[model samples]
Target chain A: MSTSRELTRCKTFIPGFDLISNGGLPAGRTTLVSGGPGSAKTILAAQFLAEGIRNASQPGCFVTFEEQPADIRRNLASFGWNIEKWEDENKWIFVDGSLHPKDEPVMVGDYDLGGLMARVNHAVRTINAQRVSLDSIGAMLVQFGMPVVIRRELYRVAWQLREMDVTSIITAEHTGQAEAPVEEYVADNVIILRNTLEEEKRRRTLEILKFRGASHLKGEFPFTISEDSGIILLPLSSIELRQKSSDKRITSGISELDAMCGGGFYRDSVVLVSGATGTGKTLTATQFLAALGEDERGLLFAFEESRDQLYRNALGWGVDFPSLEAAGRLRIVSEYPEVAAPEDHLLRIKKQIEDFQPTRTAVDSLSALERISTVRTFREFVLALTSYLKDKQIAGVFTSTTPSLLGGSTVTEAHISSVTDSIILLRYVEAFGEMRRGITVLKMRGSQHDRNIREYSIDSGGMHIGEPFRGISGILSGQFTHSTSSELQTLHRMFENDDEES
Target chain B: MCKDFLGNHVMLEIIDVLQRPDEAENEKILATPTLIRQSPGPARRLVGDLGEPDRLIQLLGLQDHIRPRQ
Candidate 1:
């Protein structure tokens, strides 16, 4: 086990996939890339070859069995990998194994791929390549008719590649089987890529099936392919639940509310401010940003509102967001939640956090994120995001809008509250014949908090935490009942009588 | 309803009030199981069920509503 831990890993340039694999495609071994049509199989194989040639200065041989070399070059140019340049510089070799009309006429009844192997071997020796890719081994398998013949030929190729001692990737189509019959027992490692519709939007996910003599993160990680970033994998399984705990606390901008929270929220803690619509959720989040020190920076991800709209709203609450932005103490990123996958959202937030390195972060409302994906995906996104922030030791404040005006609902109730270190519930309490907003510290993990449901109001001064609702009951239930004056007087008289008798 | 009035009257009434849309909005009858008495010196409104008879009587001065059990 320890030896495997210390085993040398060939890091792939394909971002998060390598991280999840514990290391990239075990060194000097074969990895099978299985996926359906248009599932990024060819792109991954090309990236592996390109990554090797460019980063490691390790020349590679891309043996294409489907697309012609020229066509491959055309496709790879979009990824900014100049295949022609590498080929001309003698740093890379392209072995076109694609079946042509000439090969069709030359074929006989009894045949062997000895000629193909010779061509690949000559190319590998020419460049002294360190990596090799056999894209769409399925195409070659189809060329060989019988299953027994295909398996025998594949084993021979696998053996030859093993003898060559260069890391290799063989791409194949997933034929609805655990181990696709052809390359079943051949490859040292197997990775399956899936492209399926999730709520009418395309969602791509990849999973590692088997890693010989190595342990890897075990789960299907979501990925996306873009023009710029070829294949971006969001590996949730690789994320360790090891966040450093801090004794320090950060203020929520509202001093009284901070006081109620027993000296504010803990630094590196995830605090959720959940309430109904139009109940000052965003305003409270702005106050959190305002509370940052002069040198400290805050990053706000506004999903429900635009950056300009947030600025206007914060200005109304006297947050001075414009001044903060001008002073370089704040960054507000506004984007629609439905525009991308939940995994993309995680990666985008991570990218922002890395670039901005903010002391504080606030997602204006996580409720909108719930609308973009399934509940399971949303939960994973939230957990992954919060744990990541905690790892960075940044104070994160997320706002969620509850559906009900009284006491229930919001994303917090969707088990998001359990992951958060603190939960503050804001609700509308009817008092004095009008709707009045109230705030309460529902749960504060690892800290003492005032449990009283204090009436609060949003005004020009922002959210002000006033005294606890005195002589009233059922505030949380949305029922307002003030102590009856006559009853109070009777109680006072009774108390006086008892005092006089004593 | 009688069991709740005998049991945790205040809690039951609060829950009941929260469930109802109209009654919870009413400023006069804010809480549920609101027991109101008229023509008893002066009208009085009690927020919850009259769990404790003596306290309820003194609160609303409802002497007529109180019936002594044999």
Candidate 2:
């Protein structure tokens, strides 16, 4: 029995088809690559041979029964492999198995793949081919009418190739049957490639259905075939790369804001600052940039404010934009929601992240993003942006403007709340005939935080957070009444009665 | 309905529901905007626009911790 610790060491390699047969086709075993028309069986087989030649410095052989050698060469040209050049260097071999008109026909009992097997053996021995790909076994099977004869010939060919000590990939055409071909049952591996339509979108997927003698991943893997890169497999769905924990924290620049966040926000955490207009959402975000000190780098993406106005307004908040820019720690980019797509914005931010490598990033207000696309698109954008920031392990702060300050209504900012690791709510609270600002920590995932609603104020010196309310009523409703007055009178009467009794 | 001051002594779960009432309330039974203070004592229910944290604090007789309004 395997313990948890021992089981953790097991790793599987996807051999471009059902799991690569334990240590990849037994180092000298025969495997089959079978698929229907346009199933990319040839491409898969060729890629296996090509990858070995390029990556492993191991020579390989490609025997084609369907397409001409020139056509295969042209098709794989985009992947930067020169098969013809490799053939000249005596490192790779390509064999054309198309029958000629002058070839003589023989009886079923006398017919054999003796010539084909000899050529394959010679190619492996002469070029030192470590890998070999037979484009399609279907053509060979078609030539033999009797199932028993065909099966016997295929078995003989597989054993001969194994004796040559080459990792062989035999290709077959799938006929949409519930059961695989007879050759597949005898082979060491079986892989299936297919296209599926989901929600009117066509997706190309690959699954390793079986790999004999090997424990393989059984789920379908999503991949894309580009004109330049051919097939590029994305990260598998099963693996999760966790973010490294750090002790560093980011300041909101505003002293009051920083205090509300338990001294400061954690490094690499996403913070959502949501408030109504004129409540200083952008100012709070700018304060965050200003508090980074002279050495720390900060990036600010303003979708609503222009470059000049942003600088001027930030200056009003006592932030030294000129000096920060001169020190090479602060970068500001102005974006327009109407003119650019979300992808364009993502690319621009990605470039900035690469160039500046800032420790902190702020999206000045998500309201602008709402104007550019549908809710679904906006959500996707937020997810992608958060994923990108998490990849860089940079602390990000996003400001969102709620439509109103009171009553139960969807705070336009609701869409992005889930993606943010923390939410800081700023709003106006009325008390004693005056409107005061209040701040509260709505949620802070994976960290402990103060939950009390504290009164906050902003003046020439910047923001300030005060103690919690003492003896008032209706704090969230922007109204506060003194309950102490009536209670004090009652206490005085009780004291007088106690004195009389004494 | 009851009110209190010094929300520090308030039930944490009640505070959570009060902060985001829209999400906590169930509309299936015509249960419009109900606030259930489920901690620090017996649970109490308050209906209507209980948006004013100060008033709720006062009605709950928790003014000792609350400071006098400026």
Candidate 3:
């Protein structure tokens, strides 16, 4: 709102879209939407108008050249958009440019979009529409079979829309992944939606290719089309690292572990519990979630185990998950990671956390989800979930199952180690030919923590962190070399001499 | 063709897209020599050359409006 002012933007009100677009599409201008077949380009265009009507109470016009108006009404109805009712209410209008099979127009000479333009103009005028969507301009391109003329006509149409002062979207088909359609030059703004199958998993992303006079977040942001909510973006890169740090500490439920973490973890920090199979990572997460105070609530996204299995496991560790849940202090959502895509899972998890208003959350074994996604997708998922929890100021404990049972890191830890505030490594230690479990505070941010690898035992009463392992070396590297007490004394002397020199 | 079909009875309104672009745009008159029934209960349109008088009349449902050329 200054003398040297930027173009006022028209907010689409699509979830996460406005945020990434830096306050929505440039107002009073047309933005070309390009994507491949089935990339939801039409949906995005229609949603530009639908969201305008539903959220801003702004009337909109839909000019379809590909699908008939009847089919559009029915197809978009699944999104809970009552187009017919909106049309009657004068909130939405459609200018049908779709040619019928029985009455295909005879092209004798030069032509223009004059008819389509007039219809759209009348439709907009009738409703005083603020938004317009021209879906799949590729159809018009095919109908004319002249890219030059079509592009020129489209430029005229875009200019006409600007004259109407309606912020609009014109969707065109992107022929391939690498090909840029010539029609994109019709508008100053461009957005591309991609639905790609990476590593046998479907991943959808939306990227703002160019904004002529506007600023926006760059790069492809992962998005998902929910059953009810259409397209939702996980704009993790937009999350600022500005969460206020809390000095208040909360226990890990295990006192020795708390002492090792220097009087417990920060109230709103994320902890990663990494372990191999049978190393009690879930137990660690359960303990972290179970330590919730009376007023505090915990939400557990159990990915590796079901509700009954988690309950039984917690019961075996002397924690009554059922009663805690019944008392409304805790909520557990256990599901198989294969049920949904990573983006969908993030949405569902975020929804659950929002609905429950939890003070802390534990996603037991995030490694389960890694199997269903590519490395990059899995990393983004973790980063997104971690940032969400941090932004909410909710403490989170996510367990990552390491592939190697004896010791060694996992792809999950490799990806998400920097995102989390602390990493609690659980390992299987071999001592005197006996399989013993060990726990260590690998790293803690902004806190003093014990560096010793302590022995821990899981029993009916749960895990107990005992003293640090003695006369052992290379436990972290999965190599167990036991040393005699005399050799340990020599090693202590060597450290003692080095300490004296320092 | 339309003159041969039913000449003096049908009133013709001609629009050159070059001349009245706004009116052409408003009426969606894209092609040259396009014919439209403006006052009919439902508007009927034919784009390009209106070939074959009988077929054009049938296509436009102009039987009632047609009288033997006066």
Q: Which candidate is the best by DockQ?
A: 3
True interface contacts reproduced by each model, as a fraction? 0.00, 0.00, 0.22
User: lDDT score, residue A230, model 3?
Assistant: 76
| Model 1 agreement with the true structure over A101-144: per-residue lDDT tens digits | 43222111233444455556667777898888888777865654
Which tens-of-lDDT digit does each residue in A1-502 have in candidate 2?
4333221111112233322222344457676767777767787787777777776778888888667688889989887778888889887887666433233122212344544565566567778987888888776555434566556767787899878777787888887578877776777667777655444444456666666655556666555454453554332333334667566776767666566667778888888887767777788788888778556799999999998898888777677787888888889888787665554566567778999999889998777877775565466567767767876888898888767674122344476676678888777776676777777788887777777878877765556779876555555544455668778688779999999999
Q: What RMSD does each model have against the real structure?
A: 34.0, 32.7, 3.9
lDDT of 2 by residue, B1-70 (tens): 2223343444443323323323332210011233444444454444334556667665444566564454
CA lDDT of every candidate: 0.77, 0.66, 0.85
Question: Per-prediction DockQ, in order?
Answer: 0.00, 0.00, 0.23
- Candidate 1: RMSD over Cα atoms? 34.0
Off by over 4 Å in 1: A1-8, A101-106, A141-148, A175-182, A185-188, A471-502, B1-70
Weakest ten-residue segment in model 3 chain A by summed lDDT = A101-110
lDDT of 3 at B44: 61
Q: What iRMS does model 2 reach? A: 41.3
Candidate 2, superposed: residue stretches over 4 Å from native: A1-26, A35-40, A98-110, A138-152, A175-184, A226-228, A241-243, A252-257, A270-392, A396-442, A452-502, B1-70
TM-score (all chains, Cα) for each model: 0.78, 0.55, 0.90
